[model samples]
Target: MTQQIQQAIAKLEETMRSIGVLDFSGEVQLLEWSKSTSRDGPKIKFMMQDDDSVLPFEVATVKKGKMAGQIYHVFAIRVDDLPIKTNESEIIALEPAAKQPNRLAQAMHTDGYFRNSKLWTGMEIAEAYSQLDHKSYVEKLPCCGTKFAKHIACNGDVVGHHVKTSANSGIRIKPPHWYLVPLCHNHHMTWAHGSHAGSATHEDRHDLLLPHAVALTANQMKVKAKKIMGISSLSEITIELLDAFEEEIFGEAGNKYEDFK
Candidate 1:
């Protein structure tokens, strides 16, 4: 494998460890490569989809001038054969709108979520996530992955996470869309809202955050999207990852304390 391909593969391999995906091996196929111009000058981007035709882990490399970096990113909605959110029969896939409150809860509602009440409007629920986000591992649930819309109006509160795409770090070119990574309330409230954690090192907590998956997937989509749109700044795209934790718990948007009580 070429160094570029090796880098992409290596990143994919490490990312799969977090996503709990199967190893990708045998025949690292060349899917697509395109030449484009950004402020950074001439660039080449290659993309691949997980079709089950190949193993799940492979690197995607982006080259700019002489400098290069390997980034691993993921998308919540399963594309083609991706193991999560791709189910056609599921309510999230069939209804198309069951994305926010989370497809997992919808899929499990009949089995007894929301206290078996089923009062959910398919909208996102806050308390349901309290137990999940506290764990050290990054939130892996598709429903809780990330949430954002192009030109999403902000209420100014940190609602979700956005993957990094800086010229030096991940995406040299500004990504064209706003995204919401499903981050833990703790990370959002404690670290983001205030200062870093005490006992655990910042690097240690950072090792546990959402990484290249979302941003890289955005690049893959940009390949196919091929539409002219404004690119988001690196600072704008960087809220997705963090390396701190605190005891004070923040709350999610559109949540009612009375309901949870």
Candidate 2:
């Protein structure tokens, strides 16, 4: 390892040393997939786990129970400050620019938490909130609103129900505002999940909400959104920058959607 990399490992080791210890928890540490790996490149792994929880353990494949794969170099979190220890002999504290993909220097919502399912990664839900219509999200829908409709006056009791979810309560990720609205749990669970009748569907919500979620995340108002989306030193986020990330991740679909637009 280069002197620079050794120094980074030393810093992270020091940080890990200082944090309080807890019961066994998972972590994402750096690895060298091959000797040719660049100094900036560290093979990230979700690390192994054995319990009711996984720091999103397993790996390959996708969906409900578990898939199998490793994770990589993301930063530490202020909350849930678990004891920091590593099994890996080599972990690098790359510069912020070279840290890892997504500038994931710090942990995002799903960085090291065990998820209930893998049918789809938490990644989709993490970004799903951004693809919604912010103005229509609140102004138009008092009770319920889909991509096509704006806020409709509540015919019944309404509360902020998150747009993204399935029947599985265990399956959830942080949602951005405009991603949530005044709707009963029935709408959040039953209606959107296709378990009931509504003009929009869970699938529709997923698809419709995605592009707008991409755009809408740029407008994350909630503190939770700010943390999960990694907004710091700013209140509002740039739609264009996030859009570019969407374009990079989603290709053309990241730009916009038809029914949603």
Candidate 3:
């Protein structure tokens, strides 16, 4: 590793120790540094061994620093202090950012914590759903299609349903928001959950909603790209950029629908 990165890692170690990060000991190992993207700045990954598992820390350079507009590394206190002798899971749970993929998931790929770093919490997905037009986004769900329209109108209680359960690994962790689709109570549970046998399965819902989810993500990326790149034409957005944005959601190739199932 370069001298500067080594220095940064040393400084991070010091910060963690001083902040009482609950048994922050052992060597601080570099995991991976996710390259900078239009939507997000660069992220640095490090881990401190605890026992059988290690505690990971994902840090990013300050976009706006007080030092003459220079973007530099600073150990900004995310929380007042971590609980002493806290377990790895609890320590991770304490970190709000640790739950999402943006930085944590990006770092996780190298450590096998997650295959995809573009997952979202249920609340985040719900917020996105809230911002969209009900008719276009929610009403268009496979469950709400013309075929099902006669059987059951949307009932106006749309909720975000995760396309893959394995993405979370368990019920405790929230699924990524990108792999979510809006579905009413009946579709989400009654049909999708297999309560109504032979009805639309989760896979069916995923197939129907995948295109819409991709389009929504692409549109969001375009907006961010335009602002960051200062471009107007939609055609200016490159496929590589779009792919990167998709990676931010779906993660690497193994995270696709087929792999998830």
Candidate 4:
């Protein structure tokens, strides 16, 4: 290794020691810096040893500082290959940048929604939520939300039920979907995967509600119209009754069916 690489390794070793990490034997190599599309700023790869495991990491956004005429660099490292300790005590000092706004920090904040608290693996939670029923109530839903819906509908065999906390806390609510309105499996999946997934595709306000326009079919629309007319069946409506009902109920509300059609 060159002098710069040697210096980096020595710094990492010292960092490990300062953070109370033990058994710190590893190899460090200086890699070409590259920007991350999935995260903030530039990154470099670092390899380390961890008790029968070879840990690889992407050190993001290295910041250089000069102290007493000596130059020092701090690296924002992500444990890419495995789950490392993320507790405040274990991580806060090593990654103070985590306290700032960034994608990694946002992901860490929302991780509880995607990952299982007990197993601490994405696969485990994916499997569990995949079997959930899509049309069920939110309170009764298991990890019930758009995220669960995507896991069950597109990628797997399960359906997600919507759920909101009663007091807005804990998993006590049994059927989450009951509280939420029904959404098609596709739209539900999209919303669960990302925040931008369900937002309007175009810049216009009219375009924002486009998904609602195309959501129902002609048959579904007719059924909805029939319900609003308080008619038991579609055949019960006369032209005169339709006109009067349209003026009374639908004229002011606008033609929602027209948008769907």
TM-score of each model, in listed order? 0.21, 0.24, 0.33, 0.20
Q: Taking the tens digit of each residue's C-alpha lDDT, what string does model 3 give over 142-258? A: 333223223444454667665564544466675445545566776666655654655665666556555444434333333333333333333243444434544444453333223
Worst 10 residues of 1 by lDDT: 239-248
**Residue-wise C-alpha lDDT for candidate 2, range 1-261, written one tens digit per residue:** 456755675566556534522212223333334443554344334332122123112111122233222223545532222343487654443222232223221222223211112201233454533324343444333333322232222244444555554442234555544345445444444454444345465566667544443322322322223334454322233444444444433453232222222
Among these predictions, the greatest TM-score belongs to: 3
Please identify model 4 stretches exceeding 4 Å from their true place.
1-213, 216-224, 228-230, 250-261
Q: Over the stretch 1-261, how does candidate 4's per-residue lDDT look in tens digits?
A: 466766776677667644533222333333334666764556555432211122101111123332112122455433223344566323211221222233322332244211222221222233322112213322222222232232334333334323333332365545322123334445455543335644323331123222221121122233333444665343354444444544554243222233212
TM-score (C-alpha, index-matched) for candidate 4: 0.20
Clash number for model 2?
Answer: 36
Candidate 1 lDDT over residue span 1-261, tens digit each: 356766776576557644544323223222333455564444323232222222122222233344244444433222233243455432222222221332322332233322211212111132322212312122332212122111222232334444333421354553222223433454444443435443223442343232333332332222111111122111111111110000111222222222222
What is the TM-score (0 to 1) of candidate 1? 0.21
Candidate-wise lDDT, in order: 0.29, 0.36, 0.41, 0.33
